[model samples]
Target: MLAPSPLGRVLLHLSNLLVIAFLLLPIAAVTLGALQAEKTLQADTRALLPPEWTLDNFRVILSGGEQRGAIFEQVTYLPDNVKKIRFAFTNSTVIALSVTVLTLAMGALSAWTIARLRYRWTRWLVNASLLARFVPVITLMIPLYVAFRQLGLLNSVVGVIVALTGFLLPYAILILAPYFDQIPKELEDSARIDGCSRFGAFWRVSLPLAAPGLASCGALVFIISWNELLIPLILVNKAEFMTVPVVINSLVGDVHVFFNLMMAICLLALLPSVILVLLLQKFVVAGLQVGGLKG
Candidate 1:
């Protein structure tokens, strides 16, 4: 294929810019909303920008509703959930990390088996795993809720972790199996010939060789788990067990909505996943490239 001419190239660049702007518009809105007081936000819904800016929203949220600052001086009541932002942050971090580790460990082993083993059952298992992703998670919520209630796992961080791991495990397996298959079997064989056990060879050789795939799958898992709201919302109703997304959801009350405060919290909530993706982007891109290539 020939390269595009100057006008075509300019059009392509313009299209890309348009897409980027579309994506960033929400972030820009959130930042602007977080910078201003609620009165300014409501006063001029028609305006593109707030009349004045303040960090009082951040101050109130970070201070757990203690320091109202000038912005919230007249406001008397804050949601109980809003005051427990620290708990939500802690719960989200712990759950995301836990889900990432569990998904990677289980996914790697299962993916390796599916990739290396020729058994019919392994093929069936892989297909089944893929099919699981087709079922809407919402449909399973009721059954999961009942089961967790019976197991006394509701309203706990452990419950959220387990639910997220199960929901995300199939995607991890699909992402990782191709990478494992692309690995040279000779590497594991060499490790095995050096007196390493089968599992040991995999642990030391194949696993490390698949580092990029792991990083890719892990970053994706962490982000999904961090942003997951439905599973946690259904599984854990208690504020102490609430994740960042759950806390953000709590901001929408029946009578009033704290748009500025919610936006500030949203910005805070977005940092970890954004930083994780940025740090792992190279590995993620490489892994995706390798995973997609045929042997």
Candidate 2:
């Protein structure tokens, strides 16, 4: 490939800057909003910045809504939603992590079989996963809610993890299988000729080579499970079982909306997934590129 001309490089840089600005605009607004007091937020509709800055919103949420150090002395009434922060955060972490682990472990094995075996049934299975991806999630809510209620899984984290894992498994397989297919079969064959069983060959040979696919799949699963709102909202009613998104939803009301508080929690909710993606971006790109190019 030839190197780009000067004008081409300038245009490329300008395009990148515009894309970055577009993506960061909402995030910047949320971060700034979270740093200001509620009165300041309401006072200025057109102001580019807050009239006065305060970390009290974050302090209240992180402190479980307790007044501290006389700064929050005037804040007499803390909402029940604020008190649920710790529980909601813990629940979100547990559920997201559980779903990612479950999806990765189960999906990898299934994808491996489908990719390597090349049988008629395996193709059907991949096709079914593709079909599952196309199904509208809202369509399943009613039936899922009824089933969870019957199974006594309505307020349990285990139930949420199971549901998310099932939904995300298809995506994981779609990402992983193609990359697995790209692996040279001669590696596994050599291992097998050396008396390693098929599963052993997979364990020792294929798994290591497929690390990029696994990393990408796990990150995608984690992000999807963490951001998922519909199923959790339908199934979980109690504050004890609520995740971050549901708790955030509860903050919305006709009487009053805590925009600053909501923004603070949202920023908190976004951090883990963002950090995971940044840390594993290389693997994610590698996996996607390989998967797309290969069978």
Each model's C-alpha lDDT?
Answer: 0.86, 0.84
Best by TM-score: 1
TM-score of each model, in listed order: 0.92, 0.90
Please give the RMSD to the true structure for each candidate, in Å: 2.9, 3.0
Candidate 2's TM-score: 0.90
Model 1 gets an lDDT of: 0.86
Segments of candidate 2 deviating more than 4 angstroms = 1-15, 68-72, 286-295
In model 1, which residue pairs have backbone atoms overlapping below 3 Å? Answer: none
Pairs that clash in candidate 2: none
* TM-score attained by model 1: 0.92
> Mind giving the per-residue lDDT tens digits that candidate 2 earns over 201-291?
8889999999878988887778778888998999899999999989888877725546887888899989988898789998766655643
Indicate the residue-level lDDT of 189 in model 2. 98
The local lDDT score (0 to 100) that residue 163 gets in candidate 2 is 84
